[model samples]
Target: MRLVKTEKTGRSVHWPTIAALAFLVPVLLTALGDAKGAEPEHRPLMSFEYDPSSEVDVELVLAVDISQSMDTDEQEVQRAGYIAALTSEEFLNAVQYGPTGRIAVIYMEWGGVDEHFLVADWTVIKDAATARIFAGQIAEAPLRQVQRTSITSALTKSVSLVNENAYQGLRRVIDISGDGPNNQGGSVTKVRDHLVSAGITINGLPLMMKTSTNTWQAMLNLDHYYEDCVIGGPGSFAIPVKSKDGFADAIRMKLVMEIAGLTFDRPSFHPVADRRPVRCDLFD
Candidate 1:
């Protein structure tokens, strides 16, 4: 992965090269058909080597923010955090203790409705080597798009991706990490409610750090906005990483909680005064 300095923001971020995979003509045809609003294509006859029926306990999908606000430095930290978590001994232990000793994840970057890119899809990490390969692939993929933050789109697409997996896991989760609130697309509250009701847990990593003294107040304001509208479902909670340095710790903690399926006592950190529950009715 090459770290690139953002010209506009003067921040350095790691940019990874894309890996080329052999394309099957039939698969391409199915994708084309789906794009044309035809009937949904049937599942592929081929499958990954990993055994999904071995009772895998958890399936985690990470939805990361690659919006314009996240400068190169911040994005690098975010990417590194996930890489470290996936390769960590603790995470592996959690996976092994489960029935299948496996965890499948889809790495996606999202900004707005039209800006979701699947960097990696449903890679089952059963060993250290597999985990490293997944991480390396993520590190090499370039940032696909940049727009406004749309937490709703990320959550919606994530739910769809997880359902597409054939793994029979005990738990399903969508880990969403963002440094800003939803300012694009439809209402986030509506999407949040719909996903939560579908029995998918939604956890959040909200970056509250300020890049400049002038942006501190604005960042703090947005943090509160996230606490209200962006997190929900069983064991759902938002952990604030006050700065880039805290990214690793926050990510580690979130991963452990997800693997263990731990529940939170309450939503403790409220950054805004309108500490009301996120209600879709308000927007309607």
Candidate 2:
């Protein structure tokens, strides 16, 4: 071993010092990697964490229902619809229509009193690649279910989740989809009203499945119930699904509508025939 001298200062670099740096280079890299939350490799000898901030036209929360009222087959159809919509070329095109060309999305599957499960955490979908990756993740997630329908719980959870997130947006929305009424939680109207008044929109995807059921879980005029109670905000509306086969198309239309921020004039999603108004206070 020999020293590499510093000619300008006439100082000799010792072999021991050179050996010490050689030994610590990898260790230092690993320390930097640990500073980040996680990485591909647990102990990365070298890595970089890129944290870039972005703006978007909206922050949308896809709050879906997994209550038993939706049978396993209907659940499957609903899940499939979202996967198709999220990955569709239309969805990708909708993203580009935004002012910033990106949006933050959160996906939740809920049922029961306090039942809220995150199928996908906060993710920025800016391009086809990112959209596909998100769609694949949701496509692969295990289908889950619980008892009861708590629209109130879903609303509360969504508000908390959005408030705790890191992204800032010009608009914030909770796209709540459910097949039944509020049969299991706190006051849905109160929570819905609070969120709407705070400038956070609540959109609805009122699914009309199990329409003929004679059980306590059955909800007739769910679409009207949603309009009277659940959805509210600027440009907010409910696009009801009338059957299993129409689920995907409904999902796609709604996604494109929300992402593009299109009004009733958008060809993809036309309004359903208006039903007579229901009691917004029916659930209390």
Candidate 3:
């Protein structure tokens, strides 16, 4: 979907709200140390160096799957793909379009209700150097244990992050990348409905590498599941990567489309009429 260009002045940036207690409380507590009054170790403030004068267009949250279904090799491929995209020249070209065309990405791994960790939070990548650093950090971080796929919880959490931040962008999107169907927590459709109603877009990247003889059938089924249950908002679409080798290209393509706020002319990939059921192979 094309993002509507909106005028943004300094006053409209919500600096006061950004400085409010909700954001400041943690900083204050850390600076003051524990209740015993001992000096706490110093840490850098969580802020980005992007030029605010440039046009701001998109805020994206990447909710990645780390469920037990994805083995270590698969996890490595996923992580590497993102890192490569961050450093690619194509991504840099995408960032230069707007005055301050910045993409604030929050990298998170989600499985079960209790198994989401923020590997990277709200980092703005405006230049190639910064993007490379962010990618390196992501590459070095250890993959956490997976539990279950909770599409509803991940969507809810991503929406909250975007709402809390002050972004003068034309579009807000949640990019969910997973390899399995939702089998835990609340209904995925309900969450998608709520996010759609709030004018937020949800896109899906379903990984379909592990299916046996029915690989194509499994992908078709998974695509249908995502369309019916997880994707929403204007111009939302799902792009499936049939194998690990396809991950980098898929992500790069999606990023380009998203950063440009481009609309999809063709209909999104939907399931064929006679697809088979997704056996609970990952869960069992």
Candidate 4:
């Protein structure tokens, strides 16, 4: 059974009414990285002079969904996949290739409009040892499920988290992973557009392992929804996970791309560039 609790904000947003609200035009984003298909693993690490002002190369918020729609088994797979990716050789190598060789990360879970929980606080990971410690904390943390899906609330909280954090980075990114669309809280497209305007990049991981026609929340072509409505800003992209086994690989690839600020030309990687510009009324 899914748990229900009062929202901490003490406010409720009607989804239908909120959806009707006008959306701001999104700012065009410049693509990051070069045309050469340079994989992070193959890139050579270069020495960087440490600037006290910029502590890390990127500040990343890993916002994962924990709504009742995701079963316990699926949740475990999701959690495990992150752990594996963080400790993977590719991720560690990518960190070293960065100018700072360090990145700040926050792992958070969200469900309803008010159900954003911080599983792991902002931690700087520069090497394998620090990465292991961060991964260990994630592995030890308990998982809980809340009712409803609210990508809007999650993005709102992510922006706030980035603003509140002390570490300054060359890039700010929110890596959002979810299985459903926003059926609660305010309009996701509005919040996404706001983030893009503020120069915050948003990437997405659309979990499609359990897509079904019977489930109301299990949306089809979720990757399209993410690309067209959820993600924005420079170098924004969405990678859909069609099977349970693809989670780790997809996550590792996304992290490497974000940390190294590079994009691969592989077919599996979907960059939101050179396509139609994102519109506010996508879902409607």
CA lDDT of each candidate?
Answer: 0.77, 0.84, 0.78, 0.84
Better of 2 and 4 by TM-score: 2
Q: Count the backbone clashes (under 3 Å) in each candidate.
A: 5, 0, 4, 0
In TM-score terms, which candidate is top?
2
Write one digit per residue (lDDT tens) for candidate 4, span 1-284: 23334489756666554444533212112123332444556767798776585588999999999999888998999999999999999999999998988999999999988899998999999999999999998899998999998899999999999999989889999999998778877689989999999999999998888775435435346777787788888888788888888988999989999898875466343444755444435433
Q: Which residue pairs of candidate 4 clash?
A: none
Q: Give lDDT for model 1.
A: 0.77
Model 2 per-residue lDDT tens digits across residues 23-56: 9999999998887766565664787755456567
RMSD of each: 26.8, 15.6, 21.8, 27.7
Predicted candidate 1 versus true structure: per-residue lDDT over 76-189, tens digit per residue: 888888888888988777777766677777899999876788887778877888888898888888755496877878888899988887776788899998877677778888
The alpha-carbon deviation from the true structure for residue 209 of candidate 4, after best TM-score superposition, in angstroms, is 0.4
Arrange candidates by TM-score, descending.
Answer: 2, 4, 3, 1
Model 2 scores worst on lDDT over the 10 consecutive residues at 267-276
Q: Which stretches in model 3 have alpha-carbon errors above 4 Å?
A: 1-55, 213-220, 271-284
Q: Is candidate 3 or candidate 4 better by lDDT?
A: 4
Off by over 4 Å in 4: 1-54, 212-219, 264-284
| lDDT per residue (tens digit) for residues 95-197 in model 3 | 7785566777778889987567888877778898779878878988988767788887888889888888766567889999988777777677777888999
Model 4 lDDT at residue 245: 86
Task: Tell me the lDDT of model 2 at 27.
Answer: 99
Query: Of 1 and 4, which scores higher on TM-score?
Result: 4
